[model samples]
Target: MKNLKALLAVPAAFGAVLAVSGNAVAAESLVEENLVESVAVESVAVEAADTVEAADVMVAEPIQLAQVTSVSELSDVRASDWAFTALQRLVEEYGCLEGYPDRTFRGNRAMTRYEFAAGLNACLDVVIQLIGGGDLTDVRRLQEEFAAELATIRGRTDLLEADVAELEANQFSTTTKLRGQVDAHLVVPFGEADGEVPLLDDDGNQATDPDGTPLTTRDTLEEADATFEYRARLNFDTSFTGEDRLRLRLQASDSASSLVNAGGLASQSGRRNGFEDNIGLDDVYYSFPIGNRISGIIAANSIVTDDFVTSTIVPYDGPAVADVSGPVFYDQFAGGNFGAGVNFAFTDNLVLDLGYSSEASNVNTDDGGIFEEYSYIAQLNFLTDGLFNAAVTYIDGESDELDTPDYTIAGLLNLDFGRVEVGGHYAYSPSDDGDQDSYGLGVTVPDLFGAGNQLGLYGTILPDDEDEPLVVEAYYQLGLNEYFSITPAVIYADNDSGDDSENIYGALRATFNF
Candidate 1:
């Protein structure tokens, strides 16, 4: 062992030299690198040899000796302590100091000279490694070699630490998760059709006044240029219980639809576009499970009609599809409103759902109307989530213009073939004046263009025997990235206003999700 006195002589003398020269003081900064050898040799025979002994040194168990990564692990090393930074440096940066069995330094307790000397020896070893091979000349060599590079690295590390601190200080909600979607549509429609008095597929009666004659108009639809607009929705989803979700969706839409391309007179557009740009909070709902099989949802401002077991059996209803979604009058009951619904699972694959909604409930009778618009619906669903699925739906609809409830029964089904999926829905809509039937059929070729790419052909028939409202929509959807996609589609409508004239429409739909 080199004498402790000798090990200390070089560092003490070098410190004196650094003290005299500003450059040396700055250059001798990293003790871990420049003084490593001398620090290790300091446990030699003199300065600490008589003060500390091997038996007095701390011998920690394997668990207690775990490499300390956090300051919290040292029970007695409070941040408020005057020497806390030094303590942390010695424990973490140098890894030269170890705590007692209780994982604490016990700073308030007294210690023997031998214990103090042992700890000092620990620190000297770290210093020896820091100064490089226990030789002061190594410190000078390192200073000359990487002074600028180390300084730059240190500066960047400090900046990063500050950024993290700032971010943690001014953050948003802890319990709420934010999600959003945006859809932009470029629509070009061509055609103007003369309006006509229409009949139904079932030799149905016509819409008429109190008299026996039908009501008819000869209005002509006006043609326009390509229009571009967008719909955006921001959702804040919060969960009080792990199984329950509260969703608040803020939405904006300004685009309006023509009677032709936007599904003609069909209630549900087979060519589903996205939301129009009406900027406001559009949907607020809470869904919770009562048991493993029962689920429920309630809306405060807006809701989806087919919110439970009866999802609108159309692929275009999804964000992945370019077409507009949801049944127009059916989902909103003619307007966005408050509603409640429940779903009961009969088996793993079968579910039953019921709901009631009304837009006029929020309005005052004196101001506008109360109970003016409402619908109560029930649906039975059977699913395999693979080859076949079906739903039978019944809706009792009422409005200020209607004398009684309009009864409608809708059946929707989806079937899958190896690489193709086929789905359709048929609704028997009967009113006091007439009986109508609306139907849709679609075939989707998955991976036809590429993996996750789809080519879909869809058609909708709005029951009007005279001026049959028929729409055929075809689209190729391709995803460019995880959160973005583009779809180019064409729509052909046989009648825009129950007239003989036909119109063709083109659309480019782009969607982004966050």
Candidate 2:
């Protein structure tokens, strides 16, 4: 009876050995199947019969087993289980046993003979290596009994390694990633005033009509029709040092014209509606760290004031459809140009930003050079641990197109209260004609209906000495999914010029991102 009991404890002793060995590579390849457990029990009985009194051998019922890489991967194996430490030592420490591919250990299930053999064989291999091949007679007997199953497990492991190697060889770029966006717009304009308004040249001076009469806004709006336009952009972002980025963006669009003319407030016409159906390089820039707290950007093309500032502080800056998108005074000195900028962090919450840009930096003509039409901007940004954040900015520039020297100071602020946010900005630009002021207030409610859905309301007074147009916009963006969204917006503009030149526009935009 004593010998019979010792034979019965053989499997348990082998399980204990498995607990001491380290992680196993073969265990990950074990197959999930059930077979007679008597095969293993009978072998133990025959092997131990000569050394002890004869006894009956008990056969465990066949049961399902799974393969797992680590004990933690098994959902049923918890720290509180009585055998948790043993299982952890075998699977995590020695890799002698693994869980199912579906992350289950099925600890309550009975084990089949093949499963026991596989585990015992895996631990015996480790034991022999540790003991320098001086294993006892019983260990050698067990290895011979399970040799076939062990060979099968080893074969599966080799296949898994090959697959991993193939995947790594066929992987995509290691240092660069591609992202893209497409925006489609449908614009419908109504309530256009009758009678012609004088058309202004690029310099804001009145231009004569073909018949020598003054050209007017009526000539443009009367010919305007509801239109559909689209813009597509593909961005390739590459990183060389893990922290620095080089970005190249290719863009194409067919939205160069506006539906409504807001006197001189060009922002009221919308910023995204000007690509002229041409494909070109929209932006190219390289940004890198200069020091522990300083970062710099060198833009070969398409640089703007927002590139220099840390935050614009306006909630509608990306979604709004009119002047409310940003403070109008920013447009006074900050258009797309070639430039460079730097950000210096004074503290965790405070930063100083400076930038320089020139309109004709890429031109080779006598009248065109980096210094011919240039701007300098400085901004102080404040970010708090609380809900409020703000920035103050100053810009100095000269534009030969508008034939004026630009000097402007601006302040931006935002207060976020989780689902609800309020933002506003004020910009003042002093010109020889008069000091121009532009300001706007906006409110946003995010996740109004569901995740990714938003509602925004905005009102702004554009920076025009003659018109001082007031533009109001409301929009709701409905996110259908992570990669697609639709927005419907209504915009109204009325100028102090008081020609009853008020106009209303309805727009729908569909956006796809990937």
Candidate 3:
């Protein structure tokens, strides 16, 4: 059957090839025939401008003729070239190229309008191709569909093309001038659980509790204590001169109601609170280029880290046996206060970041009050085929409760393939006698459903001491379209305590970006 199909395709393929060749030859012949002829057409004569040179030339006719004629009529003919006419028209139509004066229009000198419309058109042509427009045929088809518009600019196609080129020249600066992104998600949990269990995933999915039990919306375990299951993140960044920049990041999440009992560990939410209220930062900072290879950041209140940050879509901290500065422990290390730092890029692929944080006792709350700690943080980051990062931080001074830990260390590594990403992190708090370790693996399949959408899978696991607890969670995102996605996830927790308790929770989420 395969051989028959191959044999049958041979004639059709050959015939198609021959037809394409014929079309190509026909096109080449037509193009040659349609070439603009350089015929000695009648010129649009004009009187010489009133100038002293005209008088001198009139008097020294022999000298003037010798000078002008030696330059050949063709060379002098440049004074009447079509390019000059196009430029003159451009000035008359668009005013002075934005930042120039009328007197600045130098027609006598050879100029490259390639930075104008011509350049813009060429760059756009490339962009349209990169964005999956296929090939030149697609562009021609679009032009054909908009034939009237194409026809209107046909006479000045070269100028129009240069316009795109000009835009392209500015595209880098323009895109770098100021940029912003918004990430928001609304997830609904639909798993069945008898009571509140620890959600295996900390990412805001209202899954089961740490104990092996299911959580539901109904009355059985409705009043369990937990942060809201919904999470939202918004960030904006602006870069000036492609170097110095400013950034503002915000994380917000809704509260969850769930109960969990692991060993002697138990948490019951008196009321549901958002993730932001529990473990996130609301910060703004300004970054300025310090030297040729260094930048400085001035932040009053910010979230600063030395490691590659994973998504807050989950509720658990990263896996670092000794996470000294983790949210679960510090809750607000370099956050909820003021701080500053410097980042140095020793090489194109290596970076060193150091920052100092001081608290004026602003983050005052019942959980942790007026933390009057001084945080010193440093991190060394390297990137080659993938990324390797290590960070160390020390907290001096005392919590309002006078229980500030001395130091924390964290390490992380990430390997990214075209569509797959795998990463792990470890955090340790030698002073507090607490440690955390976490790892995650995820993959994104592109163009699902033939709609240029994507499908993604993410899973992570975190395990602590014998009675400390273990968590596992997984999710799948099905792209509904270019700007929308539907994600469903599950979280499971097993409490190895006397009850050998387990809990499960599930969520269905929708996300949109602009």
Candidate 4:
């Protein structure tokens, strides 16, 4: 009876989760090999067992069977999960389930061999009982099909139980999980990818001849071989209340941007494909639910343009799109700010957003500090039945003109047509030095050549005092695997920066995600 108690207890420890993972089969097979010898020993002891007490074999505590409505109700299991099919059958037909006191099944928790065996044993008995009741359509057949596995599952439940007991006594952390993303990119620039252009200095003062000849030239394009760039980000998401999240993002990068050579309009890495050296805290933000339909964000470091904006007009905003592939009409907005913002859901498909950011918040003096280089943005977003989406935004910011302020009014829209998505944005800048307009149209064809393959074409017209430059770009994104992709793009520009500098750009970008 004592030996029987150990055997049954061993199986109870292993239980049902392992059944879905298929580890139970391996465990059962191992146990069956040992069972061949154990059963022989047991048969010889059966004559002595008749004199032994049945009390030694009975479990001290009753087995608790869970009342599960659906496999999706299990926190670790979901209808859309990869393990759904195997788990569904285990719950619906076997009726062998056990859950925590709270009713949630932590199916992802690891288990020892004994626990696996125990779970299998529980299911085996339920099936056996169903077969006897005559309602089991294939339970009997399945039981015979896995007879060896059943014996194995019952076989070394002891060792697994002991191992698990020891581990539980030494476990760590009921809260907190760590995740990370490392992205590596290879950017190759060709054709007329390097050149110099004119622009205002960081102080907002024109670094040019008063006669308009030119006081300075920014070499927008660099003449060099292909460059490799990489950025690594580690995010720590902590939650006290399940509905609130505090995120600390730490990042490091050693890459340079090729905005000019890549047919990019601005000198921003936001459009390019690299990062600066040294690790730094990129963002520190907290989000909490204000209500069922409202949420808010407060980020101290690395405030950005889209943090407050409700929707994006561009579809494929990703790495390597910096030069010619990204949303050109959105060039005037985004990046470099510190702020707090909120998103409001007026309905299921309508959202409103508001945010404020400061570029030089850390600088404090009579020079204005937090209010000196600040911006305020407001947005309204609307979507229609997964077919079309649009956004209207108004952004106000400090101007380089000392006393004056600058603002932009923009509209963006996206339309989905089966395998293709079309999107564009229009922005109008009102400034005394230059009143300008920018607009772009783009199309995305997913699965163009194969699964995960995408082809994109975009045309953009950017405002340039006297010259409106037109840029037409094309690119194809090829997925190599789950963690890697290759993007090859071509860009053609007419009247580059209003200088009539016509050029062609070819770029190959490869990204690896880890």
Candidate 5:
């Protein structure tokens, strides 16, 4: 029978080599008695192959070691010495010494003969259950002195159990997580392109054509051509208490904005264009947390007020486009599609926010639900830890189909410096038929020609009640890595009238993330 258990483990390997040679002669140096005789001879050769097995062996679940009852609770073991009384008698009389669930006992580095044979097979399974049946002859003489570190820790624990069973069989959710993005674009439009510019409305006036002539921009850039457009999204996000989040997203688009058919040259590159290309559910939030300086959100569908601000301290609000990205009176008075919001934090650089949206919160008659066509907001952020920030908003919309109720007021700013930044914005709404406004200013720069490159430069005036055109833009981007990017851009517009107004455009975009 295996040579009669190797001749009855030669008197239990001569009583574990005389109890590790009396704890390495009560160690006090010779390098802690050669580190307790090289961790009890590499832990009796990992418990002499614990009764050998193998075919499909996995073996990984190990860390749960806290046992230590005084090697002075090992925070780097000490007590004036080399192996303090042999780790306080193998940690208080055979408790099988342990430490390192951060209780650390990393006695000055270097271990790894497969972590000293997994700490000597956990002190030989607590000294073979405190000496009741031992005779593996010091685990076959430390399994012939560490048989190649226990076969390289069982072939790296069977290749980490076959890479954790192929990542739990190709995991795609254990509480959601998707994320995506696309973009594309192309656009063109160049200076007046052949005159006839007129057709304006949405309060920029001049719209005629019912035989009444005047509706032109050369027939809307000869029927809006030179295009390409695209968009895509995905998101998903979910979480169930890692401090909340939910999201949803999904989307698709046609993404127009080749100067939005000319007339006063509309452009925010058509602000994420019209989803007429299908795939829906554009957003449906949830966000959470409410004690530790508040936080909240509840969207139910595309909402916006910069998603309850905490900083709109613009920076071309994410690369720019014609309307200098934001503050067209907060997208004409704060967004909608249902909403709710919060944000408190009064410090760590201030915050306050608040929100409410509803372009018919899912509509339901009586002039449609949720306070009919609403919008509300409030802001105040500030933030800083260097690189300045700012905010200040207020809104209050209403629109029984525009029967009036506007009120707006906005502000934002940013600064940076360390390769430029500077941003700015301003809005104003006030309508009794005429007091709208908008503003912008930008600069960016950022690693200009390399590292996630960028460039930008802007100017604006856009929100009008009559003649506010004036735009200007420029772009660069060019990331090309962590999932792509391109950009290009250039715009111009004018419409201060006085003869051939003005126009120009050109774009490129490209993007892609995942």
Candidate 6:
């Protein structure tokens, strides 16, 4: 069996009337205010009266907390950590918790009965609240059976039982982790049915949509797909913290799509032609901070400004709607990347954010050859009055042969008035290189049909009149419950080359926190 030591440390809040000054004082409350404060003072002190008295019940050595995986992880664990914080103080000042020399605490490992029992008793002893009501006989009997090992509380089984019992009574807040979700998609488009249209390719090839019967099969058109997609993530929380956390993000989306017909002709072309799809990643990152004033993260898909933006149709928001999808962007940054920043409150209606991330790269050979490289991105943001939010971003160090450009400037803004929220953006490339200018805008609100649900309406227009053709997109998402939702969306394009195009997309998903 796994040593129960790890499990014994779980938080178990119990209260008792500690006769103080001849009056009843809630032990839980007193510990919150006084015991914690006492430990915070410079040197640790154990008042003789406050120390745990030797009883038939045993005590255990303390276990140290784990080092956070990243800066963001640290912030998340700290926020919403009231009960855990109290426990931490008790363990630290009491010199009861032991950490491995390597410094890892293995906070999630399971625990045995003895270890759990000792931890419970120690917590109860320090809080001095478990003395009044419960029968001590059962606790004493259990401790004696494990006395050889429970002599000092270094992971005893009886204490573990008591701790588990207290937790089941809902004496504290700490959420338990349960399940996860995995997603995958692929999207791609190549042959334009219209001969006059400019093909959507990196080489600027002339598009050719042969004279096939006009696809009147459906109200919507589907683009060709090239690759398949995949994604997975886990969510969990402790009631004590009152905060939820998610981790391990991975996604790969196919780059092409197939035509869906609304009419009979759709069946005849069922086996028509399909092309190979390229794959891309989506925004793959973990978020875990709870308090309003502080939080941070380290992720490859980390976009400081994208967190607050409304639409992707705007030219400068980064890439055009067609060029950027959730999966493509995910792989573009690779998950091993790191970043750190904080949200600072200037006042009720104002705030600021600053952050930075390192770039990643790799090489693949086509027919023959070899190459190598790396990249980095940086950003700054400011917001006020729920009306305006502005951000600037820069991308530097893309390799030459990979066809990746060196730099681009991006910005995003949101304006809220009464019941409507409006958003806008712009992006520019300084060199004569790849992808020039882009821009977009959108709006949203609540209870459009007089129902409890919210309603969102958004639209984006991208690319300056001169270079890249214009592309427009719009979408709406309705929340049906805490874990279920539906999104309906559409896109249209009018290129300088003269071939007009349109697309409609929709999805319904059932989500739950584990």
lDDT of candidates 1 onward, in order: 0.59, 0.68, 0.41, 0.60, 0.64, 0.37
**Which digits, one per residue and each the tens of the lDDT, describe model 5 over residues 376-465?**
789988888578888888878676434233787878888888788888888877677787677888888887879878787877786667
Candidate 6, 22: how far from true, in Å? 25
Highest lDDT: give the candidate number.
2
**Residue lDDT tens for model 2, 1-514:** 4335344445544873433222221232221111132335567656456223211111222224444557777787799999887776666554556555455666665655445665677665545444444455666787999999999999999999999899778766778889999887777877765445544432233445445565444443644687777778889999999999999988776532343454332222112322146687878999999889999998877777677777787878776654346666655664444789999999999999999887666668464777777778899989875698999999898775452435888999999899899999998877777778888999999889999888999888877666687888899989999999988988887776666667788888888999
Badly placed stretches (over 4 Å) of model 1 are 1-170, 194-223, 257-261, 264-277, 308-310, 319-336, 362-373, 402-405, 463-466, 496-498
Better of 1 and 3 by lDDT: 1
TM-score of each: 0.58, 0.63, 0.47, 0.60, 0.26, 0.42
Query: Candidate 4 at 446: error in angstroms?
Result: 1.8
Residue 503 accuracy (lDDT) in model 2: 75
Error of 6 at 507 (Å): 6.5
Residues 1-514 of candidate 4 have per-residue lDDT tens digits of 4334334433433336364323233343344354455556566576345323322232223334446657766676667767577556556645566554344555565665545666676666664453454344465678899999978877768779988888777654334444576655555555443346433321222334334553323454445456566667778878877888888877776534433423442112221122246577777888788989999988777776565665675775553354334443333433343678898999988999988776555666443666776667788999776778998988777634432326778888889887899888888776666766777888898788788888888887765445577777787889998777877777676655444355565656665555
Which lDDT tens digits does candidate 6 get at residues 232-268?
A: 4443333334443444332222222331210011001
Candidate 2: regions farther than 4 A off: 1-172, 194-224, 262-275, 334-337, 403-405
Off by over 4 Å in 6: 1-246, 250-296, 300-376, 401-406, 450-454, 462-467, 500-514
Off by over 4 Å in 4: 1-145, 151-177, 183-185, 193-195, 198-224, 255-257, 261-276, 323-337, 362-367, 401-405, 449-451, 495-500
True lDDT of residue 48, candidate 4: 48
* Residue 491 Cα positional deviation in candidate 3, in Å, after optimal superposition: 1.5
Which ranges in model 5 have alpha carbons more than 4 Å from their true place? 1-133, 136-183, 186-220, 229-257, 260-325, 328-347, 351-380, 383-390, 393-409, 412-436, 439-461, 465-510
Q: On TM-score, who's better, 2 or 5?
A: 2
- Candidate 3 local lDDT, 34-62, one digit each (tens): 33221223232322222323333433331
**How many residue pairs clash (N, CA or C atoms closer than 3 angstroms) in each of the candidate models, in the order given?**
32, 9, 67, 13, 2, 73
Preferred candidate (TM-score higher): 1 or 6: 1
